[model samples]
Target chain A: MDNLNVLDIFKALSNETRLNILRWLREPEKNFPAQQAHLPKEVSIEGGVCVGDIQEKVNLSQSTVSHYLSLMQKAGLLEAVRYGQWTYYRRNEETLAKITKFINEEI
Target chain B: MDNLNVLDIFKALSNETRLNILRWLREPEKNFPAQQAHLPKEVSIEGGVCVGDIQEKVNLSQSTVSHYLSLMQKAGLLEAVRYGQWTYYRRNEETLAKITKFINEEI
Candidate 1:
């Protein structure tokens, strides 16, 4: 992505909670509960974890976590997968690599 | 700096103007005017640019520029040196290196 869009990513990552979310998503299996018990089989662990589980893990209000996830998604830091009524969130590793490259060479 | 302080740095850098300021300081000689013309020799261009010059370059009010510089200093993104009546600001290269490492390893 361009520098301006990368600035938006930085803005999204400015918040501590949002930053924590991104870190946690980097290691999904460790952060969230088992899928068969907490999520449907179709929503595999590799795909992502449900928003409600993330809300519970973060101990924030559902809307707040939802908002943070949406902001990260907009910045291309995270990807949201819709399966039935549940919205699963996962880190966009490729975009993250781009961010790392931007930091290394640009800012 | 710790992860928490790094988050504060990210918060300080969230603004476009603030981020631009950091990038400009990366090449101070290129971005600001010569010291002999605008500032005293003892002030030393290597130390930093006078806050007035930064304000002029940013096209913002003195107080606004001062506030941004102060915030950046508090976050360890910039260092402020007081020479006579002028406060000169420059990039904290060491702290920036630490931030880059943090992003590489942590988040």
Candidate 2:
């Protein structure tokens, strides 16, 4: 996104829990619990971690985590994928890189 | 600064005006009007720009600019010094570098 909306991304990241969620999502395998159920061969865990899994790690209410994930997604900091009732969220690396580059130039 | 307080830095930086103030401070001579007053050799413009000068550049009220500067300073994103009656503010390079390093390692 452009510089203007980048402010929104910064706003999304200002919260501690939300920032931690994004940082935690960086290493999904290490951070999230194992799914006992059969996994789809095509649905890679690398794509994202489910909301339930994230809440378990953060010690936050499900609703709070859900709200943070939604805000992060809205800011283009994270991407959300829904599989049934579970919503998986992960950082959008491209956007993160864009922010890094923008900071390098602008800051 | 510790990892926990980096969140405060992000919060301080979330606003456009605050971020712009920090960015503009990076090149103070270019961004602000020339200080025509008699120089104190020890008083380096490199150290910081005055709050009044920042207010002019940002088109913000004195209190608003002062408040933002205090927040940024509290966050460790900026440093402030008192020069006579004026308080001068500038980016804290070491803190900024620490944050950049943190983001590189964490995000």
After superposition on all CA atoms, what RMSD does each candidate show versus the true structure? 2.4, 2.3
Worst 10 residues of 1 chain A by lDDT: A34-43
| lDDT per residue (tens digit) for residues A4-98 in model 2 | 37788889878888888888888777777785233477766465888878888889898888888888888889998777777778889878877
Local accuracy of candidate 2 as per-residue lDDT tens digits, B1-107: 36448778888878989989988988887888865243487666565888888888899888998899999999888888776777778888877777767777787
Query: Each model: TM-score of chain B?
Result: 0.87, 0.88
CAPRI level of candidate 1: medium
- Provide per-model DockQ scores: 0.60, 0.71
lDDT of 1 by residue, B1-107 (tens): 45438767878877888888887877777888864355555546474777887888899888999999999999988898877678888888778788777776777
TM-score of each: 0.88, 0.88
RMSD of 2: 2.3
Give the number of the best model, judged by DockQ: 2
Residue B40 CA displacement from its true place in model 2, Å: 3.4
